[model samples]
Target: MTQDPVSIEPLCLDEGHALGEFYPLKQQAQAEDFPADPAACRKDFLGQILHPRPGNSVLAWGARMGGRPVGLCAVGVPEAGRRWTADVVHFVVHPDVRRTGIGSRLLATATGHLAGLGVQKMTAFTSGPADGAGAGDAFAEATGAARILRYQRLSLRIGPTRLATDGDTGAGCELLHWRDDVPAEYRAAFAAMSSRLAAEEAARSGSDQVPEDFDEDKVQELYAVLRAWGYRTYLTAVRHRETGLLVGYSALGMADSHQRHASQWDTIVLPSHRGRGLGVVLKRANLSWTVEHEPELATVTTWNAIGNPAMLHVNESFGFRLDQSGARREWTL
Candidate 1:
């Protein structure tokens, strides 16, 4: 008997039927590192396919053998300014098919597609236990992707803690909290602060990439996309009482009311505001607010680059335990 040849094809997003075929492959691929939550995963899959973020688009392909999917790949490309860059958002081959060429073929297809679009760089991530290596790392290495950065994934169980203690936000600063949307009065300041932080991070990473021009309109569009993706966002920011400027902010997002886990999005303090404990203040405020609003939420997960010790310290202070160590790899095309 001869094995059936593997066939790779683009996923049909025009209808929901393809999900039945694609979901199983996703589950099998992530079973070891990330257990599947049927409802949540379905929502996320459909949301990204149907209502992607503004200025971004996703392309997915499924590899099938014997008329069933055995591997999958999804890539995301920014539709506008960052056309030269793309992300290999999801790449997996069924465990049973490991060591076979299916994974390589899927990656080759993705790389070809990206090259056709003039993408000059592509990045992917692999995650596993903090102390052990995983299949993803091995695959990336075998494919000759350069490991550019290491990240620590941390999780915090929601509970009563000292993080809720009121802290001084400087003598002339005040804290503001909001759910779902940024208040009209703070929109401009929030956009400016976010843009600045993005630029700083890009520079710190030794990338010459320019940060997106995040204006008030762009900020509103971001929140709208998050809403479409089934997330309820919680934000906390510190503002100068006299200047009326936002000095720092932190954000947490929960997928739905039933989700027991939430994701910590970003925590940033202006350079001038550093050492004033504003990062701690912003994160604590957001975490406390999220806990209050999300009655069933159990844990919050966050990722930080290993070199960012300051942010790691703040998370550790709030009792976030190490969950996984991961590598971010990149390929130049």
Candidate 2:
């Protein structure tokens, strides 16, 4: 007997409860058994609906089979620079009905919303092959999307031991720390170094990431979003003693809802100051602090492009192990 096809409908903040039933799909789609924090998920969803990334708007839709929600698609359109790109951040369907057209239906609906918003390019990510075939890899193949680049997700367990104790800031370098926002005096230099780091990262991985023109105002805007969403950010910045300029920085962020998990966001050092071991110093300082302040934190996850060996070496030295890998994929509208 043939069954009826799933119906796709737009989802709003008020109807987000219906999408909660499919939360298990998150673990199924990823290679690792990520800790399930329903509270965190709900908080994040509501926050994005209310206050999206500094300059971005989101569109979400749910798929229903026999009048019951079974899948979801979420797309974010940039209101600022990367205007042409729409990120399909989350797309998941229950395993039982995965190949039964639910995913395709949800994807079509997501792309439709992006098209209506004048989005020219679409970007999405899928977990790398776990077993013989990972869900993300299969889905991309089925949808004719191009696999762009692969990144390694590494994690380190926080134990009672300090990984790196040598905090020596070699010749002309000094270390500074921040909790939420870059200080007034360091904003300009931080933004310049950050922008340069972003451009270099994008070029190394062949990604379509646009180098942001960060200024004091832009930095403030991002900090505002983090505060509104209940995120706590810990940062380590290295300043040049002679020039009184910031040459490198690293950031670790954790959300109140997900206390057990922390993300190692960005670690960047200016080209001229690269060989002085600033990356190691920044990472060590932040890790030491995180282990002290965030006792509940058991895991720190970080991603590095396959082409980035220097950072990979730093992470490996800190006992970080490869948990899973992911591929960035894209489609042209």
**For every model shown, what is its TM-score relative to the native structure?**
0.91, 0.87
Off by over 4 Å in 1: 35-40, 162-166, 206-213
Q: How close is candidate 2 to the true structure, as a TM-score?
A: 0.87
Q: Over the stretch 182-272, how does candidate 2's per-residue lDDT look in tens digits?
A: 8878888887877776776668756565655677777788777877767889888988888888888999888757778888988998888
In model 2, where is the ten-residue run with the lowest total lDDT?
A: 30-39
- Model 1: lDDT to the true structure: 0.79
Number of the top-ranking candidate, with TM-score as the measure: 1
**What tens-digit string does per-residue lDDT give for candidate 1 at 1-333?**
677889999887677678566766666666655663223355555566556666778888889999878888888788865787777766878887778899999988888888888888788879877788778988889988887768898998887664466566879999898999898778888998888867765655644445656888878888888888778899999988888888899998887534688889888998888987888888887877777787777788898887789999999987898988888778777
Report residue 46 deviation for candidate 2 (angstroms).
3.5
- Which pairs of residues collide in candidate 1? none
Error of 2 at 300 (Å): 1.1
